[model samples]
Target: MIFKRKSSATTWQEVLEGCLRRDTKAQRQLYERYANFAKNTCLRYAQNEVEAEEMASDGFLKVFDKIEKYDSTQPFEGWLKRIMINTAIDHYRRNSHKISWSDLDEASQVPYSDSYYKDEHLVNITADEIMMFVQRLPASYRAVFSLSVVEGYNHNEIAEMLGISESASRSNLSKAKAKLQSWISAYVIQQDEITHKHE
Candidate 1:
């Protein structure tokens, strides 16, 4: 469905009030207004578009269910983002059995560092391409990477959220960064070669 640009504050308040009252049209409007934001938030944690769509849909259902709990004084977008992140965590928990997680002992062996990606490589890569590489990471690594790197959550917070130890979170993040560094470097080299061939 085509959605107009974001509504004015007054109009948004009206929509929120209608949603609180369980008005279907208002709910539809709200979904249209924030669907892309919600999906993009989920995509960082999802392996594919289908999984991201599922997480987004589930997050909206929770938002509607708990609309009364939202604080009017705070920004609604922040509130929505938290809900989406929690939903992604919930999704991870449910699928945890299918995803392999490194043990704390093994994780402790990996050193944590964030200086692997060079500025030159990053300057040549688009955000979408970076996200694509993130999506290719192992599920556990992806969760830790996105939470730590993209969402700015510390290892302690990530451990609590994912039911893993802080060491595990650090290890997962370290591995993720290493993998991304390798993939992105290769991608940059390939692109450079293609450009040179044309030259």
Candidate 2:
């Protein structure tokens, strides 16, 4: 039998209890509530939307399978987010053969610079535009960037998670930032030229 209830009518506690009991309706409700968040979290690690969707699905499956292990002391959202991130990392590992990691030595060759665009240039760029540029990054660089910048993981933690040395994590993040700066600089210049042409 299909269980039907308005989302507002069901408290999170109730949903959690139902989920613990393995109720399909409660599971559906949970997915409806957090699917976007899961997908968005995966998108940073995934190369594209299709991969993100796959990651999100795989993440939810892991969440449901492991819900019994969740500690009550911690926030459920944080727990769920961790699962999603781990799922992305697993995806990365499975496809590691396909992803080309920059040599640790080569990473040092990429020059670091100050912010490429002025504050005014940044004001003209949308967050979506910036995310698009991030999505265009290499898989290795994108994972390091998302884990470090977006997820607030330190190099030590990132190194443990990705199974690389701390220096490699730092190198990947540096290369990621350098590449993003170059892309953003070019984009800002293109936008300025287009604006001038229209004037």
Candidate 3:
């Protein structure tokens, strides 16, 4: 029912319309365009690049399979991102039984000077490194962190999505932040020492 757009520079709206009509080329084009975005979303939740690839593929399949349900008025990229995030959450739910949650209240309470996060050494850190740190978090804490900080979901929203209490969601986010802060601080200190030694 859907025909491929004639121009190579077809707009996303045209692609969506074509995809709605089940155009194969349109589907392929859409996947190609957004695959990296999906992979990045998956990377936030997956432990490694291999798992992130799997999650991205599965999420794309869902996106195509459920394309008919997509509302045209909404931002298409945002819709796809939600699907990718949900796919990651589903993956987490399946494997989370193997992971345990811990209370890190002391870490959470550690006060840092205002300049701590602004260290020059941190500028050298890549986005991938930051994502790796997030990926290294325990399943529950990672989920809460991704939802709260990356996806901008509040505690109530995260709790509803994860079937946990709001308090638990809040707790997990706090602990995740605390852990990341400590890890980054250590990394910065190491980097500073290395720089000084080289100097």
Candidate 4:
């Protein structure tokens, strides 16, 4: 017999109903459905996997506790993701920015310069592969870069949310871009060498 893949229907109404009835299976199903997104949110704010897992656990507990109050009209993942992101933000805020990271504030905010990456439709790699390079960035730079590039948050908004000056957000984003550029360049060179050898 071919088994159907299970994806729990996670409408807010369903989840809320489950939570109200104290159904363990519903809770488990809810966690299973959003665990990956929750983990990714934790990883964005955490320095390592250990912290990320802790954040994920803490976030899920919060979700269980608060599910009853959720607005059913809104997106369920959006609600779960907000809780996860808040959990990560809490962890990050506790550590505080390092005093030595003064360079974070050294640059002025420049409008994100559009490059060939923007004008040309050339991306030789998949989003998953690009994310590999992104994950290697310093935590501050990664957060700022992800916010600006992926989330499309401007410097002022990111700075407000991150508790940094606008200049600091911009500086971190610049450093992050430089790092990604260096990584992509190296990868391109390696690809060329492998191709030439194959010829």
Clashing residue pairs, candidate 2? none
Ranking by TM-score: 1, 2, 3, 4
Using TM-score as the measure, the top candidate is: 1
lDDT of 3 by residue, 15-47 (tens): 888888889999999999998989988888888
Estimate, for each residue in 17-118, the C-alpha lDDT of model 4 and write its tens digit: 887687888788778878888887777656566778899999999998887778888887888888887776666566665522325545343233448355
- How well does each candidate superpose onto the true structure, as a TM-score? 0.90, 0.89, 0.82, 0.77
Give the 10-residue window scoring lowest on summed lDDT in candidate 4.
99-108
Work out how many backbone clashes candidate 2 has. Answer: 0
Ranking by lDDT: 1, 2, 3, 4
Over the full model, what C-alpha lDDT does candidate 4 score relative to the true structure?
0.74
- Model 4 segments more than 4 A misplaced: 1-12, 43-51, 97-113, 119-122
lDDT of each: 0.91, 0.88, 0.82, 0.74
Tens digits of lDDT, candidate 2, 50-158: 9999999999999888888989788888999999999999998888788776667888889756455445657889988988998999988999999998999999999
Off by over 4 Å in 1: 1-10, 104-113
**For this target, which candidate reaches the highest lDDT against the unseen true structure?**
1
For model 3, the run of ten residues with the poorest summed lDDT = 105-114
Give candidates' CA RMSD values in order.
Answer: 5.1, 4.2, 4.7, 5.0
